[model samples]
Target: MILLISPEQTDDIEIKTLHQLFEAGLEHFHFRKPNATLDEHRAYLEQIDPTYYPYIMTHNFPVELTQEYAIKGIHLEERKWREQGAALETYVKSFTDKGFAVSSSYHEPEDLAAQPVTFAYHLLSPVFAAISKSDMQGRGFDVRDIPKFIAGMGGINAQTTPEAVKLGFQGVGALGGVWNAKDPIQAFKEMQSAFAKAYNKKI
Candidate 1:
């Protein structure tokens, strides 16, 4: 699973490239626009071909967006997950019952291990130095012992994706690695190919 996260701010070029990416076999697009309002989010989705709606996972307005669009799933940011407290399981279940994939993010391996609520998958970050944020350093987390579908984030690209796999991530997610490249679509394909080769070797 090579998940591509949207850049914080929207750009016309990025949107156009995203259409190309979807056509080029990209799956699991994390539609995260933190600063965008619900209306803006809807506008963004409207721009994309509705046929690809099932391939998107919204990071904001999970219930509302998923209810309106046939997106793949909802991602619970660490803060939102923590806010749920005891209701976390029930909250997650509500979506899972509807046959939606529920995933969450974690910065620490220990925190992920301690999490009681099961997710469709877990996104562990800073496995490698972050490209989008210069100040964030990589922790090189090893999730081999964690019994869940884990995807590594932070500085993931064609070159570093395999390293994440070797560290035991079942999948990898990226943002800058793809959007920052000169050719976003080609970068995605390369990263996708690299992940597949590495994951195959791991098994």
Candidate 2:
């Protein structure tokens, strides 16, 4: 199970929560504070032990931020992905050549189906209603509705991870679910456990 930790707001509490996840063995921790400046982000990165996990920068800031930290991957937003067009694929290919992986977001299955570029995988969203996005509705795709090689994002947590995996999500992304939990580390573990159980039963 691949655990993605995305905190909507990065604060001292959020940083501590992330530290807990690091100790809990979550491999992929994406730093996606959209409102934070590069300097603020750097400070947050300083608190995290980069050697223990894969840290991904969610937006295309400067490549320098990632280069400085030796982070393994970058996740592009939908707008940046659309704007780059062919350049996005070229960028991923270039990163692949350099040993860095790339990921992007796609809301709909057709968008993923239409994708012609290579990425580690695309993140498809709103598998359930997220605390961060209460207004957004989930697609509620069953196993047959999902294609191969897509990660389920939005509202993913311990409670819904089983359903997400049974629906054929390659992995699951958590936002407020883990970050806002009473005990984030435990929440992460339970979520991973759920995915593992569901995945095993499916096989």
Candidate 3:
């Protein structure tokens, strides 16, 4: 799948860019705004086309909006997944019982392998160096043996996305590769082309 993550800073251009990307066949959108307030988050979603709501996934306040907006799923950050422990299991169950997909993140391949398979999917990051954060280096780990639920993330772009697919990632998630590009929509299409070229299928 081709998942586009929101940058920390959201602007009118980014919002318009995202609509264009979705219209062009972007499948998933991770709505992560760490700095935005709750009201701001609501406002941002309000501005987006309601038809695109089903493709949206939020990292924050997911429970409140999952049913409210009829969104696709919720993504629990690694911190919440770890700190909440069993309590989080109940939370996941609540959503899963209602047919909501649950996903999370893991910084290490080993951690993801060892953890119970509760999440529908989990992100394995820094797999090809971070595009948004230069200081964050790529692990270059091969996750072919891991479960299909683990998506390779970080530093994912047109060039690196195919590499991730070759590494056996069920999906690839991009942030800076799209939002940081000269033409974000074009970059997304290029990423899609790269994925198709490598995997022989559309994202």
Candidate 4:
């Protein structure tokens, strides 16, 4: 899947554009507005068409709230998985008991290798030159050893998506590649197409 991550800040225009993207078949949207308050998050969810709620995944929220918003799941930051240690297994199981899909992030292959808690997917950043952050250089990461469910993030777009999928990533996350585009919805559509073309071949 092509996961579209939200910009840290949102405006009315961006919210409307996100609706358009959902209508255009954008699945797995990681709704990560870390700075927004819970009330603000509620307001944002209220604005989105409820029919698209199932396509969203919130970052940094209580799992119970996912039920309230009908969100598909929650993505914990990499630090949580690292610091929680063995406690993560029981913590995540609680979510699974309620039928929530869990995900997390990683900065390197070694971190993923060391992680014992399984997730629906894990986002590995800086897989390519970061589209949003200039300093997080891509370094042309070789991803052969990572699990298939780990997603490649950072600077991914239509051109680089196929290669990431080919390298064994089950998914990819795009921030600047879409939100920073002249047309975010169109950028998402291209990303969807690229992911389908690449993923279909592996089957």
| Candidate that would win on TM-score | 1
TM-score order, best first, reads 1, 3, 4, 2
Model 4: ten consecutive residues of lowest lDDT = 139-148
Candidate 2 regions with alpha-carbon error over 4 angstroms: 53-57, 143-147
Name the best candidate (by lDDT): 1
Root-mean-square deviation (CA) per prediction:
0.9, 1.8, 1.8, 1.5
Task: Identify the superior model by TM-score, candidate 1 or candidate 4.
Answer: 1
Rate residue 119 of model 4 by lDDT. Answer: 88
lDDT of each: 0.92, 0.74, 0.86, 0.84
Residue range 20-62, candidate 3, lDDT tens digits: 9989998788999999987888889988899998888889887
lDDT of 4 by residue, 136-186 (tens): 888556676765477889889988999888877888899999999998888
lDDT of 1 at 104: 98
TM-score of predicted structure 2: 0.91
Candidate 1 lDDT over residue span 3-101, tens digit each: 999999987687789999999888899999999999999999889999998899899999799899988999998999999999999999999999899
Instruction: Tell me how many clashing residue pairs each candidate has.
Output: 0, 0, 1, 0
Better of 1 and 2 by TM-score: 1
Model 3 lDDT, residue 72, Cα:
80
What TM-score does prediction 1 earn?
A: 0.97
Q: What lDDT is reached at residue 107 by model 2?
A: 77
